[model samples]
Target chain A: MPRRDPAAFAEFVAARSPALHRAAYLMVGERQLAQDLLQESLTKTYVAWPRLRDHGKAEAYTRKVITTTAITWYRRRSWNAERPTESLPDTVAGGHDDAVTQREWLWTALQELPPRQRAAIVLRFYEDLTEAQTAEAMDCAVGTVKSQVSAGLAKLRDRLGDRFGEHADDLLPPTLMVVTP
Target chain B: MTELLKDTMDQAADSLLAPDLDVQAMVREGDRRVGRRRTAVVGAGVAAAVVAAIAVPSLLPQDQQRATEPVGFAAVFEAHQPSWATGSEVHVGGRSFDAGHQVFAYVQTTEGVVFSDPSGQVWASNGTQTVGVGRTDAEHPRLEADGSRVAWTTYGDGRPTEFTVYDQATGEVDGLAAQTGDAEVLALDGTDVYARDGREIVRWSLATGTRTSLGRPTGIEIEDVKAGVIAHQLPHADDGATSPYFGRELGETLAPDFYQTLALSPDGTTALGESEADVPALADTATGAVTPITVPGYGFFVGFGWVDDDTYVGLGVNEPYQTTPLDLLECEVGGTCTVTAEAIGSAASGVVLPFGQSMDD
Candidate 1:
């Protein structure tokens, strides 16, 4: 087996940390937890660096590690128990009031989803991956990815509809509305 | 709404400033993990080699062993196929047989191998012939075998309503209706069938057709049972920690912590708990003593089952990060493990081991 190149690993981490951390933050809904998830995933990626063969695919592998590890963490009772309460800002200090509220609502709704559904949504919408790619990342079948993504979108719409009433359709993208229905 | 969802997610992610990348720390942790894994593999290899060199020849003569040893539960432990094997294949005691249908759960008996397919149809294969025994619910069906009997729970309206036991000797199948409608079979010990009915563990006697409540229900989740010994987890604490307990006396804890999966040995004397290092530990059910068994080349052990009283088997994943290339490993309580079959496929492969069927599902 070839030895892992430390310099190459460092370069990969430096280049991809920003994007991976963002995705982690979206999946976990917490800054510190996202940081921890990213760091742990990077450590795992570093360990598998030698077997990775093509360093170009490191980002994909790290994304998968993040998705699976996040799911594992969420499955633990301790992680669910220790989840901090979401405290949305009461007043929109800066203008763009409706957009801020919508963002807050969407974020809270995303966090409310089950771990697998949340991961599927993030991998599909946020990462712009296909259903097959999402399944690969989640270590599940493509059918499972489709169901999870649909279930997640339907949940988001229901929450949005409950809150926004008739304006829910306007808030959701046309493509999501079509598939979810 | 796809565009909006993507845009919203992007905006939310972009708003948070990225935490500083700790390249040095990551590298250090990565090196530590690799070193620990390599050390375990090397140590296990040396121990196995030493045992093979010193113990094999002196134990017993081949002819003498064949004459004296009884064919029983130990035969089940010998059933394993290559990791890449499909569900249609069955291997037991150095012999391979075709089940025709994809086997999801199986056990080896003195007469033949009794197994369940993905459709929940039970079949028995005896080298030359295969016959259908019975059927259970295709979804999440449970099967257990001990001595000459094979037992499984039958479902009605998505809930377990009864359990059926098949006698390999007489080719008789007995259906004993459960006292409770929602009970699921946990383990089989000769004539006694242990099951979890809601939060309480119940024991049913196939001989007398009577149900006995093991203990008061405190909303416990039964993990496994052997003989009359029951392994259970208490409800989650305020801190989200659940303690494992053995037998009816739930006040005394068995181990400080265990990973998601737990199983008791067939004799109920030892319990397999995953340690912090991801290796399986043998915990003495009575004394609460834990001994970590060393397994080579695997980072994690899951779905544990005892082949006999002292020996156990589980699925060993070589790389925790990557789910593929799982190996079926057999390890003795205080001894090293031999990879019974290598590359037994990934978690998604639908390969089932005799023990740890619940965890595999």
Candidate 2:
């Protein structure tokens, strides 16, 4: 029943687009997909705009949409054919460097994390949101966030191994600590 | 250490994201999408043709032929708990983990469930023994299986660049130049594959190695094509959420909307809903009308799909309102849903069904 006020929706898009895009990119590990995710979320938000009494709630709702939609897209896309595009990260200039390789390794490793876990990591560490906030954004119980985060970090640790180097332990939250030592 | 990881991630995001979004452009795009969604609802049938395709399979005689008591219809669903997905026992790409390492998509065939693991490797499971088919390097591996044939696309970077078909019965693999001129593949149906090449639907027959254009009905992207009956889904995902009709061919066709369940009876005369609210129903493919068939024990089953024209197959939730282990079940058209508890392991749970054909396995 809600419809977005054009002016209000535009204003929100202009103001929050960058941050939302960054969060989306972090979750999906790709720029184009992040753009799609943001666009769809904003469009959906626009549709539900009139229904929301408090405009301030839009950010939280949009964040949840991004996380949930990213997971849905990831799941739906698994069986569909990929459109050939030059979206894969271009060959890095310092391809020979170990740090660059490690960074690339970490990037690939992050991509491997299931959507919810990647979402938890991005919200908790990247966006500096708390575990509770991540849970709220993910529309899941706090315990689920904790488990997903733990699972994600464990997968990352397993895949990256020594290539991830020291400080890897810090990647996990203090509660669900997973350290090689 | 957390700060460093954050820094790297932030840097990656920064490097990838554009400096800023075009505000006016976004508003225009948003309006455009909404406008498109508003107009996307249109509704299906190629009945006489689909009889051979969807029917012949279900028409097969059952193992139980009764004299004193009537025999029932039920699909042997390979029931596994939700936790089974993250149980950390699956070996894919030579690594075993759970939760994140899980089956992303699956095709339930008579042989078993041919599924794609997180790493895009195809594996077939009949609840017990699972065998990994050829390792499909396709990243997303849009896996589609009909009978003994399974096909998926290999993606490089993120785009679907190529599609490959695997035949389980023969252990033979054939790669389709499946991507059309636009370099996009849509649907793969056995040797007769379908793909969206830009604006055109490219029908490439892998069996004959012939490629042609099917100027299909506009506004409909054919989702399922069996026995010449093509199932269409709107190109836009938003429009798909509410529309009950999958796509129209000769008449209005019914689609699965609740609990992610859909069953097209073998004869194409009956359509069943997974939700208990709408159980046994007959679909008028010509008028898009639905007539619910009441049964003696209607509310006791979770619809998996139709195993025959006269009956629908599913799991029996004997205990009301509980997460109970399901039994193989049958909801006879204009009859009751009979539960066979002896088929203990047969229940559809914990599966990512793309096209919503759960009873096939």
> What is the C-alpha DockQ of each candidate?
0.21, 0.11
Per residue, candidate 1 scores C-alpha lDDT tens digits across A1-181 of: 1367889999998888999999998888888899999999999888767645557667887888899889988887555567984544444346387777787788788888888998999998888888877876786788888888878877888899988998887776553443332
Superposed by TM-score, candidate 2 places the C-alpha of residue B241 at a distance from the truth, in angstroms, of 8.9
TM-score of chain A of each: 0.88, 0.79
Per-residue lDDT of B134-162 in model 2, one digit per residue for the tens? 44443334455455565565445554455
Give the winner by TM-score. 1
* Local error of candidate 1 at residue B150 (angstroms): 2.6
Model 1's number of clashes is 7
> What DockQ score does model 1 reach against the true complex?
0.21
Q: Highest lDDT, which number?
A: 1
Compute each candidate's TM-score over C-alphas.
0.51, 0.40
Q: What does fnat come to for each candidate?
A: 0.54, 0.26
Off by over 4 Å in 2: A1-181, B1-104, B125-130, B134-142, B157-160, B180-191, B216-223, B233-263, B266-270, B273-282, B293-302, B315-328, B341-361
